[model samples]
Target: MWNQPYLETCCRSALHRLTLVGRPGRPDGLKDGPCLRRLEGMGLARQREDGRFEATPAGWDRHALEIVPRKSA
Candidate 1:
């Protein structure tokens, strides 16, 4: 569902890092805003007890599919 360029970039960043700590406004933090809420609703993202945002396995799978294929030189 996160096929848009911006959304994919954000999700990829989150998936690659695995955890986003502290407040939602931080550059590296993922907020519980509309976008994230939708991801959470889809069982893709979750908010941790310590307020960290984490991507689920399904999220990783989806994000992985979006990775660009590298060409062999």
Candidate 2:
């Protein structure tokens, strides 16, 4: 499981086109890439060959609750 802080830091906007992590203006920041890489290493996501980082299947599993609809009573 990804650390709460790290997971919370992940960009959640569906329309967000920025693949690079960290602050919005600075794409070449020191901590951003590494932090994103660490998440990739942990199987939370994958850095695509196209330079975009996408959440892996396991990553989806980790966030399943967010995707799954609640059962109607």
Candidate 3:
């Protein structure tokens, strides 16, 4: 199961584009930490040779599913 930290982690989700891990001057900018490393290990995200991080296809799908609220009766 996904933990709060994982769900709350900052992400930029778009239909046609993947996530960029860090942002300029953002307090929540991606840090080189365990969470990020875990994401990469799961193949949900990747760190480029240039040290930039981006979301993989699986990551994109996960993010999309996360954003949509499930209907309740």
lDDT tens digits, residue span 1-73, model 2: 7544344444333212222332232232334566556656767567666566666666555555443435779
RMSD of candidate 2 to the truth, in angstroms, is: 7.3
Those runs of model 2 whose alpha carbons end farther than 4 Å from true positions after fitting are 1-32, 65-73
| Clashing pairs in model 3, backbone N/Cα/C closer than 3 A | none
1-73, model 3: which lDDT tens digit per residue? 7753354344323211334433321121345344555666767677676665566777766765676545779
- TM-score of each model, paired residue for residue: 0.49, 0.45, 0.51
Question: Least accurate stretch of 10 residues (summed lDDT) in model 1?
Answer: 19-28
Best by TM-score: 3
Q: Write the per-residue lDDT of candidate 1 for residues 14-40, one digit (tens) a residue.
A: 544543432342232536344565566
Model 2, position 58: C-alpha lDDT score: 64
* Better by lDDT, candidate 2 or 1: 1
